[model samples]
Target: MSSLNTNTNIKSEIDIRKKANYKTEGSDNIRTKKQKKYVLIDGHVYDFLKRSFDIIFAIMFLMIASPVMLVVAFLIKLEDGGPIVHARICIGKNNREYKMYKFRSMIPNADQMFQLFTPEQMERYKVGAKFDDDPRLTRVGKFIRRISIDELPQLFSVVRNDMSVIGPRPVIEREAAAYGENRNKLLSVKPGITGWWQVNGRSDCAYLSDEAKNLQLYYVDHRSMGLDIKILLKTFKVVFYGKGAR
Candidate 1:
């Protein structure tokens, strides 16, 4: 009888221990969920402010840049009698695809011209989806891209809520694939016109490279109003100096 009692006590003790561990694990999971919820709530205010600023800034800048945009449009049309705006499908927040607009900075049907690239040019294009001296650029294309005037039309995208003023620059589908498992994280926030990557080194840091990936991920993880302001200031400097404009 005593042995049976002892066995019963051991069984009870084991049952108690199992319950304790289960409770601990359950509580841990609840805590993790709560923490994630808190982060989302905390970022809500920041997102609101950022969106407000994007609209105001884009609208104001668009008004100021209207004359320049008209001149660019005229020049592009006169140069080749082709479309003045280039619309590209880029991956945006939450893996949503959107059309991103830029002033036409390349000849008409430039995408079809890729097959004509020389081996060296093709290799360089594979590195960053850009050419150091692309033959596809029109005379005016070269000038506008050099000064980043080509990017002005993206203000319309910002106003449309398709992009942010300071975030990772939107990537084409092929470029987005390079993010691999981290693609969701990269697309967790809206892509930007000028970003940490733009101000850091632009084309010098190849989009396919690990350095570029880390820099872009760093921005996504650490973005805030202060960081946005710093990026904006640096962007002006970069534009004026034409740093890494290739």
Candidate 2:
């Protein structure tokens, strides 16, 4: 009788353990489903169309802007004989690192000029990695930045499939921390030369602020062809007015 009792006790303990394991698995499945709700799934058709548009836009713009690019290159060379393009290591789609090119807009070795920053400038840089009245900007750099001309070189990146014409602007690896939990979602799509945030408020929205994170996530969540066209149209207005340019 005692043996039967011991056997019954063991069976009860095993049943309890099985129930606990089942509950744990159920909770995990629930959490996984919740995460899936946030995952962006750009269908194959959308991807193809977006890529086609990016290529067409980049080729046409490069042709039209070739002369302007040459002139800008000459001015940059004349100013300091430094590299005409500045390549920044930025976080791209799927958290890959890529060199994002821009017209060199600062003095050569500008990345190593942190020691020259005032305490105030250092604080500003910590916030957004940029500030007005930057001491590092050359004269041509200042003009190009103000007119958004420095960004023109990113067209090549678009052609290379490293970027899109419209998407979230790529952030440096350090800046990716600003997106917090949504960082993966932000990197799910290729970064862009212009984006929802760029046309909305650009530099006026502090990079580390909640507003900037929300704007970037909103684009990731709601990206569509219509919305892309809308952003492209608004970009012209923003660039023309130099809104939020520094």
Candidate 3:
């Protein structure tokens, strides 16, 4: 499970992905829907039905969560008078970059405060790309994070067509290099707010480790509308139980 070969073209890439899938799962487990969806067009497998579902799901979630988002926004602002939404460039389909949004769950200028962390904490942060006991989190931030409320702002990204409702979670641009040859395959489809790895273990899986990499790759290789629906249903239970959240 090292990086894929660098010389692979679009068809070859798809072939390699299919071959990888076959090795990972028995042929009997291979779903035709997954195979049909990845015939690349201009370096992407456009699934209009999935995009349509994303649009509909985004609209419905927005409609249902608008009032709750407003309340969360007001509380965030009231706590420290800081920006309610945090935006950062995240890599999306075909290596395109877009601003991904989330509620600001940390103090303003938290990046600057990273220097204050102890060396051990900084080492952990570098390894995992997240802090198990983050000191920058605001009081309201801690609460919102525990219940997974901080991600509601990303519904806007979904509506804006920057992400799908169910797919691989987008990664920051700096983190994209780690994918190496798999980068193109990873970016061949739209990134999502939730997906297989997320529903399976969320933050518990070490970033860039085999567990995380394999899960993400498995999702990309074996993706289908049916798989997406299954992941979505599992996501609800994960959310309700607050499973694997930081």
Candidate 4:
């Protein structure tokens, strides 16, 4: 009996040693992987700089556009009796939800009408599919959207840190859900009021069919302060000329 007890003790000690060795090796491997995981551009310093730029741009844009914003609000209400701006839930960085504001381009209660007309609406919306002569649009809304002024309200969102002036456009939660692996890259930056897709021509571009990959990959590989400025200038030209519009 004593011999058997000794044998059991030896086996238990061996098992404990094996487990300890495994844990040590496993922990070391985990540490090594963590060390190798981060890319240089995505390091802590780059993140801090990126955030600083976003904040600075947000503040200045809000200040500069304040007067224009008030004028837009007044015109919207003057043309028709409805809310000056529209707000909807938009997905942000990290799959977070925030209310996004835009100039109201559709009639009141259009949200309710959306379900009934979705299939029919697809035929109407072309070049990213829009009803060129949508009955729901008010006179002021038409003018506002033509010049892309309808998007000006989102400067407030940029200031609020709910959005960026230049990132990929925010997808709705439903859109985000369909993203799958794309969401990982898409949600890395805050959604922008204007983006690669916007400047490339929202009106001329295909929907998720053709343009999504161009915008998505461009955003992932080539995002920079200079790129954002370039896109803004391009947007100005597009809006001014009324080229490729809905």
Q: What TM-score does model 4 achieve against the real structure? A: 0.74
TM-score quality measure for candidate 2: 0.81
User: What's the TM-score of each model vs. the native?
Assistant: 0.83, 0.81, 0.80, 0.74
Q: Which ten residues in a row have the lowest lDDT in candidate 4?
A: 122-131
Winning model by TM-score: 1
Angstrom error of the Cα, residue 66, model 2: value is 0.6
Model 1 global lDDT (CA atoms, 0 to 1) = 0.92
- Of 1 and 3, the candidate ahead on lDDT is 1
Global Cα RMSD, each model? 5.4, 8.4, 15.1, 7.7
- What TM-score quantifies how close candidate 1 is to the native fold? 0.83
In model 1, where is the ten-residue run with the lowest total lDDT?
A: 124-133
Clashing pairs in 4: 125-129, 125-130, 126-129, 126-130
Tens-digit lDDT string for candidate 1 (67-160): 9999999999999899999999999999999999999989889989987788989987887856557999999999999899999999999999
Worst 10 residues of 2 by lDDT: 36-45
Q: Which segments of candidate 2 are over 4 A away from where they belong?
A: 1-42
**Residue-by-residue lDDT tens digits, candidate 3, 17-66:** 99988877775446554565445542243477788888898889889998
Give the C-alpha miss distance for residue 61 in model 1, angstroms. 0.2
| Model 1, runs deviating above 4 Å | 1-41
Pick the lDDT winner: 1
Candidate 4, residues 42-117, lDDT tens digits: the string is 5666657666767787778778988888898898888878998899998898888899988898888766665545
